[model samples]
Target: MTRRNRSGSIGFIVDDLNPMLRGWFNYFKHAYRTEYREIDGFIRRRLRAILLRHNKRKGLGITLDAHCQWTNAYFAELGLFTMHEARVLACRPR
Candidate 1:
């Protein structure tokens, strides 16, 4: 996904990512909590990088702004599926 088209809109990127994230999470639902957290962070960081590159911005101010603004909930709002959330749901008693 690192090579994902930076020209695409964030919504388009999220739409492309959700299915892959869901499938991978389903397969590794039983993995350790820390592992899920780690992977989740990695994915979010990569997405942030994509966002930063898409915006064509540089310097710490923009980077910090992006990190602060484009948070987990923001991504969730954009329909980005999170592995940590999926794990919690999978482990929940129904």
Candidate 2:
């Protein structure tokens, strides 16, 4: 997803990758009995990662602002924060 960028809407990228992602999920589900929710969450993280990668090399504040709604979970996934820290962040008002 390094090929994607923040220069335009994400709809086009999703549209382009939908078939490949579906195929991957199908293979995992059949070969490993993966849970739908797990695969779904994984895909969400992947998409988020792509966005973060694209948003990198910019101001830290801008990067964070680009995904404020994704903060705690995202940072936790990156090991930038512990789960407890993320939970506390989730509990705080914006």
Candidate 3:
């Protein structure tokens, strides 16, 4: 499906990197270990939960290559992942 993104570009600053690594690493750890396995629901439900606290203007999907890289850096600065990445990760095949 087509996803929406916010206008303008996003960037990263040095101060926010640590928290971003912590948060994303925490998320990756839980996800890799199948922490959400017992929860019976749509992927969107879990995806939404993961992304609910993040910025919504960055679009979603694997097609977002450069955008995703910029977003990762930007959110890393902001100490969060772009909501779009959550959607992409959720939609990704196991």
Candidate 4:
């Protein structure tokens, strides 16, 4: 994945490619689109790597910011996480 600077351009590679995470990659592709392809790609790779690494290490209790409450609620509606659970998860220690 390529980290982007303030101007919104590719900064660098985050990791090597992995075919198993196509779905996650596609989600980022849709989120960032062409204007920020590099950044999106980098995030996809990085997130995939982090998830995989965490799984291998059996790490859990992850948390995230509740900045976008509506978004989190939507995700919960879609069965991603409960609102209360997401809030707690958002503050999980790294």
Candidate 5:
């Protein structure tokens, strides 16, 4: 989803990504020791990179600034699926 020339809103990308993430999470939910946090972080980092590129900026300072601006909560608001949440829900007793 981090294609350099990809055009469209972040919402569009998240909409396309959600289903794939859900399917993958369902299939792998049985793995009790999976590092969902790391997976979520990786996804978020790629998303951050996309945002950075979209804004045509670079450098560690801008990257850190972006992190503060576009936080995980911001992505959640955009409906980006998170593996960490999936893990929590999957582990909950019904």
Candidate 6:
């Protein structure tokens, strides 16, 4: 996807990072066994932050959890193997 398109949608960003999800997940699991939930939450929040940045162009504002978009099954629905995938991905270097 083009840089413009990637910046416009969170889907693009996740899809773009798909190849690295496994490695990212493993790395996080191995490195931080205890902080998984917090790490996961950060990833969700980061995605919301990205959406917020994009929405600012239209002068519309939304909380990251607007309409309950962030949820327990979010990672699995996105093709992540485990709930901890969020934590792993969140801890990965940018």
User: How high is the lDDT of residue 87 in model 6?
Assistant: 62
The CA lDDT at 45 in model 3 is 33
* Model 4 C-alpha lDDT per residue in residues 20-46, reported as the tens digit of each score: 234444454444333343543344444
lDDT of 3 by residue, 1-94 (tens): 1022222222222233335534654566545544333221222332332343234435444234434444444444545434344545867899
Clashing pairs in 4: 1-14, 1-42, 2-42, 63-89, 63-90, 64-89, 64-90
TM per candidate comes to: 0.82, 0.40, 0.22, 0.25, 0.85, 0.53
Q: What is the number of backbone collisions in each predicted candidate, taken in the order shown?
A: 0, 0, 1, 7, 0, 0
What are the lDDT scores of the predictions, listed in order?
A: 0.76, 0.48, 0.38, 0.34, 0.79, 0.55
Q: Deviation in angstroms for 17 in model 1?
A: 0.8
For 1-94, candidate 5 gives per-residue lDDT tens digits of 5564467778888888889888878887878436778888888887887788778787553366788989999999998898888787867899
Model 5: residues >4 Å from true position, as ranges?
Answer: 60-62
Instruction: Please report the TM-score between candidate 3 and the true structure.
Output: 0.22
lDDT of 3 at 38: 29
Between candidates 2 and 5, the one scoring higher on lDDT is 5
> Could you list the CA RMSD of all candidates, in the order they appear?
2.4, 11.5, 11.9, 16.1, 2.1, 7.4
Q: Which stretches of candidate 2 lie over 4 Å from their true place?
A: 1-9, 24-34, 57-94
Q: Model 6: runs farther than 4 Å from truth?
A: 1-6, 57-76, 80-94
Ranking by TM-score: 5, 1, 6, 2, 4, 3
Please give the lDDT score for candidate 1: 0.76
- How big is the positional error of residue 89 in model 6, measured in Å on the Cα after superposition? 16
Most lDDT-accurate candidate: 5
Query: Candidate 4: deviation at residue 43, Å?
Result: 0.6
Q: By TM-score, who's the top model here? A: 5
Instruction: Give the clashing pairs for model 2.
Output: none
Residue 6 CA displacement from its true place in model 4, Å: 23
